[model samples]
Structure formats: structure tokens, C-alpha cells
Target: MRVVAVLAVVVLAAGCSASEPPPEDPSVDFSADDRKVTAEPFLYCDVQVKDCKRDNTAQVKLEVAPGTPVLVSVPQEVAETPWSVVIQYRTAAGEQMPPETVATFPPNKSSTFEALPPGDGDQLQTVEVKQAGAKLVRDDKGEAAAVSRGVWSAQISPPAA
Candidate 1:
């Protein structure tokens, strides 16, 4: 009888502590239908520096299903100041708006932004890396001798469906 009592206690304890996946992030609009959303292709852009030597990336063309939340992120390779973003998309009413700053980040940090889509259907998504707070130092010849460069790459996150 003692053994049975102990087993019952253990079963009750395990049942009480049952693990559950965290509720979907409130900012993200997760789909009710179990359809998987595939990741879009990498759309990258480089610094607009006139004499930029290194090839860099800044933007990516984003596409996701209606209910899938757009996960946008920028990597901080160099310790540069704040980051800003400009996103252009069609409204649910099919009106197109010019690209504008949708979000911004503070100085010298890497972060992610979660944004929801307008409504059901496809939209033209354009994400641009507006500013990374990078500066350039030049020689007397007006040539880039040294650069206070910030390397960053922007892309989608949570690749898994």
C-alpha cells in the first residue's frame, strides 16, 4: 500500500508539472491553419559608400503567408550606432505606399523586429537598411584611407515553419 501511494504521488506530481509550448508571441500573428510558411529568398544590399571596397548587404525582399508574422533582423558585425528600417508594402485595400521607416534600433546593438502583414493575400515587400551609423575617414586626396565602417546583414528569422 505504501508503494502504491508513492507511485500515485509521483504520477500526480508529473501531471501537475506538464510542459507546454510557450503561447505564440502576442506581436506575431500566428496562423490557425497548420500550413507551413516557406522562407523568402535573401535580398541583400551594400553600403552606399562611394568607394566601398567590401561587398556588404543591407536589405532583403521579404514574402510571407497572410497570417505569418514578418521576422526582420539586422546583425551587428561592427560596433556602429543605431539601425533604422524602411518597409514598403501594399495595404489590405490594395493601395501601395512608399517605403518608410517602420522601426529603429538603438546604438550598437543587434535586435529583431516582429511585424504583422496588412491582410490576406500577396504584397510587395521591400525592406531597406536606411542607416547603420557608419562613418568614413579619408586621406588628404579625398580618398578613403580609413573607414569607421559597420558591417551588417539583414534577413528573416525563425526559418522553420
Candidate 2:
């Protein structure tokens, strides 16, 4: 009888704890249907933009059905920075497609965007967000050039046919 009572108490405690919501993550969020995936910055640079490296191999994989659009939501920090979405697609014949910058948002202009899959049997392979700072990169001749200051990327897998 004592064992049964202890077991009941433990079950009740577990159930109660399970009712609490999980903590929210501070990273890029991708959602489609009822599934959601979050990815931390794969490459983040400081204000100096010199230390553009990440030690951990952090990656997020999201499975999206063909023709379905993936919704991307950035944190406030990213929203306040100038950013653009770069998408890469793969042809049905397994040929790699060129990456395209689908959308570019100015600072404080957007926090959410939709990534549409390529039509006609092509599959979306990857999605990346490149955040650029107001600063420019210097070339060999010290000319200014556009460059990304931070990078966040995610992989998208198509369902098996």
C-alpha cells in the first residue's frame, strides 16, 4: 500500500511539472504547419567584424512539404539590423541551383518573412539570413564593399516522394 501511494505521488508530481510551458529560445525561428525549428547564429561577428567565427556546429533542420511556404521570424535584435534572406534550391534532377536573395529588409522594417519553395519540382534546400552592418569592407585598394556581418542558416529537407 505504501509503494502504491508513493508511485501515485510521483506520477502526480510529474504531471504537474509537465503542465508548465517550456522556455522560449532567442534565435531565428522557422515554422511550417504545426512544426517549428529554431537555429542559433552559425556565424556571428562582433561590432569590429573581425572575429567572424563560431566554434559550435549549430544547425537546425526543418522538413517542409513541397509547395509549402516556410515562415521565418527573427528576434528583436535581428529585426533591428539590416538583413536579407538568401535561398538555395535543388532541381528535381539533383542539380544544385543558384542561391537568390529573396528579400532584403532595412533596419527595424521587418521581423518576419516567408520563404517560398521553388515551383516545378524544385525543392528548397537551404535558407540563410545575412545581417549587414552600416560599416563597409575595404578592398585591396581600400575601396568600400558590401559584406555581411553575421550569418544564420537552416537546412530544409523535402519529403520523400
Candidate 3:
């Protein structure tokens, strides 16, 4: 009788201390109504302008989920003129972020500029460009001597409960 009593106590204790099964992995494939849900990282890019004259400017908008990282590129050619290029971003709250300045470039030389996404929470971002101090001017030769810009972005959504 004593042995049976001890066995019952042990069984009860084990039942009481039982834990829930491990959570389902989000990456696993699930099909309901013949629909499969898959996990994927979100990413996107936008180009606002293809060409920019020396005195003119171009703009691009890059939007990503909060906490995402993004990379942007701007390529320009400034031949022999001691000219400067300035880049800036606008935040979701309609505020302008700090400006990035690239100093004088040799004539006929092309260079690229890059920017990283904000470290803060997810928000929409915008990019703008302009010459340091001169009004953009397109040459009469119909050659739109300008810069090329590109944006790359990625977003990670929060895990499900």
C-alpha cells in the first residue's frame, strides 16, 4: 500500500509540473484552405531621377518598415569645375534630416555617394540633391550632364504571437 501511495504522489507531481509544448517555428510552412504562409524579408528601392544637370537637382523617396536598414547611391560627374554636391533626407514627420556634403570633383570624373537608413524606429525617408551653390544648367549640346541615384532598402517585420 505504501508503495502504491508513493507512486500516485509521483504521478500527480509530474502531471502538475507538466509544461506546454514548444512554440511552432514561424519559418515552417503552413497551409490552410490550400494557402501557404511563408516568412520573407521585405525590401524595396526607388529612383526619382535618372539625370541631373550641374545647376538642377533630383529627388528620390525610400520607405521601409521601422527599424529596417537601407543603402542609397548617387553617382555624379563634375568636370574640372570646383563644384560641390549636397544630399539630404526627409523623415516621415516632414522634418529634414542633416545634409551630407561632397566637396569639389575633378572635371570629367564621376563619383558615387551613399547613405544609410535611420537607426530609429521604422519611418518613411526621402532623398534630395542639389549643387553646392550654382543653379543647375543643362548644356546646349542636349547632353544632360547629371548624376544618377539609386536606393536599396530592406524591412523585417515583428514575429507573430
Candidate 4:
């Protein structure tokens, strides 16, 4: 009887162990050269310029991996402003990539912009802003440009499956 009981206990333990899921692999498949740029969450500031007649200007920095498609979020209030907002990517060497106009939004609003890789073999990306017919206005002693007053976020990731 004792032998049978021991055998049952061993069988139960083995069954439980077999039913457990396999351990997950911690290794990520992305190459070491791949990089991503994201903006920290912060309060958006409303930018108003007198000469340009533009308002609600926000600046965001994005980092993109080579050959990867990145999505950028632009301030929403661009449409209501007098000037158009241009988005450009600046390389690490301080050279500006070709500018692409994503969208135009009304005042006190938000919008998302998508940026894709050039399909060439270049790396190291950053974002640039050019306000048409408006000069960049600096807020009270702040080095960064003023964005709309709202919760603004930006991110870079792989394309959807």
C-alpha cells in the first residue's frame, strides 16, 4: 500500500509539471543598430505670434530606426493658425531631410503625423518645425518652443502585423 501511495504522489507531481507552460525567451529579435525616438509626456503650450498670425505651435522630437516606419503626433491647432506647419527630419549631421506636410488642424485641437523611413540606408533621425508666414515665439524664458496646452504624446514602433 505504501509503495502504491508513493507511486501516486510521483505521478501527480509529474502531471502538474507537464501541464505548466514553457518558460518565455527573454531575447529580443531586433538588431542592435535599430533605434527609436519618442517624446516625453508633457503639457502642450499654445504658441501665439503677432507677425505670423499663428497660434498653438508645438515642437516634438522623434527618433526613427533605419528602414522603420515611425508615427509622429503634431499639434492639433495648426489649421486655425494663419500659417502652415511643415515637418522635417534632421539628420545627426545637422542636415535637414525633405519636409513633408502632414495635416492642418484647427485651434485648440491635436493631430497625429506619420513619418516613414526613406527606404535608403540612412540612420539617426530628428524632427524639425517650420512655420509658414510666422516667426517662432519664445515663451517666458523657456528654451523649448511653446506647444498647445494639452497632454501631447509621440512614439515610434514597428508597423502593425
lDDT of 1 by residue, 104-129 (tens): 66666645565554566535355444
Estimate, for each residue in 90-125, the C-alpha lDDT of model 3 and write its tens digit: 554656567555343454453333333344542324
TM-scores of all candidate predictions against the true structure = 0.43, 0.73, 0.27, 0.31
Better of 3 and 4 by TM-score: 4
Writing each residue's lDDT as its tens digit, candidate 2 over 53-129 gives 67356678888776677888998888998889999988767788899999999889999999886676777888888
lDDT scores in order: 0.45, 0.81, 0.35, 0.39
lDDT, candidate 4, at 94: 46
Best candidate, TM-score: 2
Error of 3 at 123 (Å): 2.6
Give the residue spans of candidate 1 off by over 4 A.
1-50, 53-62, 78-80, 118-124, 134-161
From the highest lDDT down, the ranking of the candidates is 2, 1, 4, 3
Give the C-alpha miss distance for residue 65 in model 4, angstroms. Answer: 1.6
lDDT of 4 at 33: 31
- Compared with the true structure, the alpha-carbon lDDT of candidate 2 equals 0.81
| Clash pairs, model 2 backbone | none
Question: What does each candidate score in C-alpha RMSD?
Answer: 16.0, 11.8, 23.5, 17.8
Q: Which segments of model 3 are wrong by more than 4 Å? A: 1-60, 76-110, 122-124, 133-161
Residue-level lDDT of model 4, residues 1-161, one tens digit each, is 99999999999999888865743211111111344343322332334423222222232334445555444433334324432233344454546577554444444454344444454543424332222223344768866443332332232222334
> Can you give the lDDT of residue 105 in candidate 3?
47
